[model samples]
Target: MKKYSPELINKLTDKARLLRCHVVEMIARAESGHPGGSLSAADMIAALFFHKLRHDPLKPDWADRDRMLFSKGHAAPLWYAALGECGYFPKSEFARLRECGSILQGHPDMLKTPGVNMSSGSLGQGLSIANGMALAGRIDGKDYRVYVLLGDGEIQEGQIWEAAMAAGHYSLDNLCAVLDFNGLQIDGRLQDVMNPEPIPEKWRAFGWNVIEIDGHDMSQILAAYDDAGEVKGMPTIVIGKTVKGKGVSFMEHAIGFHGVAPTEEECKQALEELGCG
Candidate 1:
């Protein structure tokens, strides 16, 4: 977790922007899928997949590699985008998203997706799987880490806390959790739907080292990642305050955009805005 050179940070940011563009394009083409949450998590996923996670695209089953569970499985577009961009699959597969026989579904399926560590999209179950992975890594004496992404709304699931308690009890310091705190969920504002306030304090109380930062700031995000790696005795939580539907003016902060796909014209505009059309 050493500091990333400014050049490396810039490269990560650029990759994140492309990740966002890919999410938009995939969703627009499929005419279905979650875009807001996916867009919000672009930088975080890019940082982990492209820079932090010790994963091999060629050997998806590398035993000692880090494990990443996307608990908010509706963000499959983003995950698939990253994996495709990472060379796990051909880029052409992105256009077939959600289509019959396509590996990229509305939610993640580990059995089908080469790089997906756990089948997710159940909303509250990913943390448990991540906990198991971390515990297994510890038992096997492996240095691999476990990373999970949770939605702001997904935190309302009581199981998240249950898993949090378990991680604390086991002192799984190798487990790192990232919350895409975009503040908006499918129905409306998360505060109105279900609030997860004092989020960092809650994690701290659960025996976690919390690092809160702007999720889109590559520099701060990378630094926070290094900070998470340095902690001992407990898990680390990163409350990444991000903009829902980031990089697209119309979709930013709009709850309606959560599960809606962009129109052809909108996609063009969005891609143009991201400079990746």
Candidate 2:
């Protein structure tokens, strides 16, 4: 668990805000891509990639680096923004997102992207990979940790529970999973679709150490992440409460914004709201 100085916290927060804007503009430029969930998860990803996770941009496969898997891979924009802005690649390449032959695809592919730990698109599978990595770390006596981000709606998949059970039973304490609890999925509200509430209790019942916090608050998000580092004998789950399309006025909590790109005007409004030009 690390205590970030005020300066570092502010730097990470600034990076997060920029990442949020990048997400919106990238989606708007592509005229396609998931924005709601990606925007919602930006702060947490920023906190991880900038301050919490231990990885080298130049050495993407560094043996001792912490691992992060995006379970809800539709939000690749946010992840790509973090990677590029944090110096994994030239930020200019971001404009080429989703283009033919571009490494930045609709979802993360470890083979293509320099910093992505794995190729992910299917729901409910990232945690399983995270668990495997944690187990391998244990067997090889490596100090690396594994983290995975899961969507609130994606939790309805039966495979998630199976992976949860396996992670708990194995006591993969080196593993941490975060739920992007924006409360909305692609179709509609999660409760209206399939409720994943009682989320913390459910994880605890499956033998994980659970905590809930505001996903957008840098302090709270950092605290939750640091706490995850201290849990020694159990997997940890941080249920991050967030609003979909958080920075844009019309998009917040709007299910229609889930997979849709914003208009040019909407992009201007969103960037303005984010305090950008």
Candidate 3:
């Protein structure tokens, strides 16, 4: 694991805050998009795209690049924010989120967006797709890894367990799944909806190397990613405990913000809170 300097940590935290601002603001501009999960995932995605993932934004189709599948694609705002921040596209595209003729859709569309390795939002199918990619990499003798992000509620689907079983059975050491365990979903708390508690134990039972950490903590997130690189003989799942709407004070853990875009007034307030201009 790499020990990050205070300067590097500060930079990553700034990026995360910037991405969170972009997510909420862009959603506000479009007047439609998921904000809660998008904001909650900002720190982790910022760290991954800017500090960890092996890919060139200038060359999105580089054959040897690592694959990233966002299983919780409702958080398309977050994905787009990270991609834009990474230079996958111009920062100007952020304002067009969810608009007609915009590549940034309500959900990630692999064919429409660069840097999105696979389309998602149907919920639990992403792990299966990620498994296929990892298996293919092994068959083709490629060293590139596959990373997937799943929402806590999204795992309520039985298909998730099935995919987990497949990944475990194959001993896909190259597959790393990140669970954004923010507790709150669109409806209410995850336990009230469909409890997937004992999350780490469950993954371990599926033959995964489980690592639990604060999803918003840059240092822990970085360490988890590094640890994933060293694990062998099994897939790894990093369970990140986070708040529903992370940076925006009003939205944090507020279920109302799950799929509701902020109004212009709300946007101004959110930006003020995020220290964004």
Best by lDDT: 1
- lDDT (C-alpha, whole model) for all candidates: 0.92, 0.91, 0.91
Q: Write the per-residue lDDT of candidate 1 for residues 1-277, one digit (tens) a residue.
A: 3466889988999999999999999999999999999999999999999899999999999999999989999999999999999999999999999998988877999998889989988898998889999999999999999999999899899999999999999999999999999998777887788788978888888888899999998988998888999899999989999999999999998889999999999999999999994
Q: TM-score per candidate, in order?
A: 0.98, 0.97, 0.98
Q: Cα lDDT for residue 42, model 3?
A: 81
lDDT of 2 at 112: 91
Candidate with the larger TM-score of 1 and 2: 1
* lDDT preference between candidates 2 and 3, better one: 2
- What residue pairs clash in candidate 2, if any at all? none
Over the stretch 174-236, how does candidate 2's per-residue lDDT look in tens digits? 999999999999888888888888898999999999989999988889999889989988999
Candidate 2 residue runs with Cα over 4 Å from true position: 1-4
For model 1, state the Cα shift of residue 100 in Å.
0.9
- TM-score of model 2 vs. true structure: 0.97
Question: Which candidate, 2 or 3, has the higher TM-score?
Answer: 3
Off by over 4 Å in 1: 1-3
Predictions: Cα RMSD each:
1.2, 1.4, 1.1
